[model samples]
Target: MRSRVLGSVLFGLGILALVFAGGLAFVVAPAAARLPYDMERTQSVAEAPNAQFLQITNGVAKVDTGTLRSTVTVQPDAKTTADLEGDLDGSALVWLVGQEVVRTDTNEVVSAYSTSYAVDRQTAAARDWNGQWLDTGSNRQSVKYTGHMYKFPFGTEKKSYDIFDRDILKAQPARFVKTEEVGGLETYQFVQEITNGRQDLPKDRLDAILGQLMPGATSGSVAYANTRTVWVEPTTGQYIRVQEKQSKTLVGNTGQSVTLLDALFTYTDDTVAKSADAASANRQKLLLVGVWGPLALALLALLLIIAGAILVTRRAAPTTAPRHAHPRHAADEDETAPIR
Candidate 1:
């Protein structure tokens, strides 16, 4: 009876443990992705070596390039894409937007632009934010620019990814270069190159835009090339630090390439430090939810099953009843009367 009671108790506890683990995985843990996300980004710009003409005094060109301030925000959206149903087996959606305002040293806003993306809840992979479906193929390249920089469950070895380019509306290849430490957090280094990015602008329109950046510049068309290096934390897919060298080249009617805009940008030190803290915090949460929680529950269930089996086997096994001789006196009397 005691064994049965103990077995029942253990079995009940095991079921509860499994239920709790399932709840943590399916409900409680998933809410981590819905946290309000915002970041203040800054990029400092300077003239590249190839930049020439104008603001030249005594062989020193006075480049007026300064800083670009960008406000990036990611918010949980009420709407979700149909593909959201397939995101790591159903995930929430978020809307990410970034606006960059380029300012001169004198604090004049020279140019501004904005971009938006829809991203997976956990992995932050790109999706069709517009809710429009396309037959472009099952294995569509995803953008990893916002929410998270790299896909979740990052690999240890070198991996190449086709990152989506919003401006060009295509995917560009980014390859893992190495692993290093950024602000004390281990990171995976990735390099991406862009060449002749197609903006679909008309030749005249391209010329007009170039003219604004560089006076008296005549071009048949414009092309863009960029080399970006990013250090992303492997556990959290956070961008700890990033560097970009982008050049806008104008191709003359004569087929000559002229460098229009060449600038190098880096994330501020403060940004790197802040991201490291955030990554550390998130790593703890992931470990608890994805690793330790389930493991503990499984172990508890196994123990309960073992205990219950032991109790059941004990009850099922036959027990021998002690053998007893017939009463001596009764046996004597029966022996005498049995002769008849």
Candidate 2:
């Protein structure tokens, strides 16, 4: 009776454990995969003014260009607004607003870029950077951030992407060049290379535009290229640091490439620190939900199953016969022999 009761208790506990494990594996785990995506992320980078490009006596010289700062805001797109409530579509939208200030004057609008992306809510892979609200040039097809938004399951040997260049006004390839540490977090470094790419303007049109900036008479087509490097935290898919090396050149009738504007952009130290903290926290949460927590639950279920099996075996019927199986068999045989 004790064995039977113990077996019953163990069996019941084993079933409960299996149910819990199943719940965690099938239901809770899937929910956790989508957790990091449902929030609004706002980040701002400071661009300090430098005197390096101020005195260029080439195609374009800065007369009174002041400090320029840009703000980028990203958010989860609303379903109703996008008409993407169905199973096949989801999006994240961002607004890029740049402001320039001359000395102590109020901020003046420099440029604005609005981008929408079709991203998988669960996986965080962006399928497409759908529409551009205010694209300044005709080469709209070459835009950046086209494919997967974040590195899903991030550890990659090389991550490749195509991003739109604001300088060249086209999309180009950016690939992982190396890995480095930023803000106490290991990160992937990617570079976007553009070399002497054609611009949307005609030669005469470009000359007309450059005539205003340059002090001398210029005649030729204008072309531009840029190199943008970024350090991204893999776990959270956030950029901790960024650098842009851009230059515009005017190819005169003599095929000379004169540098018009050369500028570099970098992120503030505080931005890297904040991004690192957020990424570290995200890594901890992913480890708990996707790795350690499931492992623990599986271990508990295995233990319950083993205990139940042992108790059930103990409660099973005996397989062997008794030693004194026929104690009365001798007497019955002897009585039968005498009567014969």
Candidate 3:
């Protein structure tokens, strides 16, 4: 009896272990492998005339799930233009321009305007609340810029900027993780590591810029990061959406930290294709579905492993003795005794 019980326990544990191992192989590993890898390609692509201009329309709303509050949105239609200066060696600049337009739903003009600039192999620049332009320059060239925005009563804003320094063309180290389909478009995802500045410009300042762009962000300096897939039109190399989360950290009177998440930007293609070939290429890659395919397979494998384990344990265990065991045995002995 004890041996049987021990076997049952061992079998149960073995089955559980097998289930966990199967999950690791099918569910966890594959999903991890499917993460997007486009960001790295975006960074390395030759500058050439690869700049794409897009228009974005977005909206925001608040959602509650139990005790959690989330800000969800159809992000705003902010126009973006990426200009590749020359050949592969030249700098590529991406501009996010905020414009005034009538909201079809409300028919009101939104007053806020913002802009972001990315220089090839250098830091990005954007206007902050205090009217000071924040510049994140590259280390090699020491490239730096100062910008000022002029807002007119007519609801249009113009940004004038000058480069103060030049940085060397040392590309930051990055890796492509996965490819995904977002909003009917294929996207590439990448992870990058950026080095912080010393002395006057430090790591905290660099981290602040990313924090402002990301949602639920904390830590003055960011080490590991998460980003939604970046959708790119394959032929034209234009970005379809740049999904980011905005986070605000506040220190309460009790010295506790509070965080908030806000959707940042979603850009769509508004440019007329130069030719039909380009449009066709973009459409063909739209439903690519590489990332999610692996994820689904992983989940299926996890479920199968769990079910198999349960079945095996049930089959390996013994069944209970028949209820008539004692009666049947006594009758057999009496018949064999021959009238004793």
Per-residue lDDT of model 3, residues 1-340, tens digit only: 5545555555555556556555655665433322121221111110102111111124232221111111112121122222232331122233333333222233333222233433322222222222112233222212223331110111111221221211211233224455666445454443333233112325554344334434454434322222323334343334344432223233323334333222233333322122223334534443222334444555555565555455545544558965764466665767767554
Local error of candidate 3 at residue 195 (angstroms) = 15
| Candidate 1 weakest ten by summed lDDT | 132-141
lDDT of each: 0.57, 0.58, 0.32
As a TM-score, model 3 comes out at: 0.27
Best prediction by lDDT: 2
Best by TM-score: 2
Tens digits of per-residue lDDT, candidate 2, 5-86, equal 7877877777787777777767776666552434655565656464123232344444334555545556555552355544
Steric overlap count per candidate = 0, 6, 29
Query: Could you tell me the lDDT of residue 314 within candidate 3?
Result: 53
Quick one: ranking by TM-score, best first?
2, 1, 3
Superposed model 3: Cα runs more than 4 Å off: 1-96, 99-113, 116-175, 181-186, 191-226, 260-340
Candidate order, lDDT descending: 2, 1, 3
lDDT for model 1: 0.57
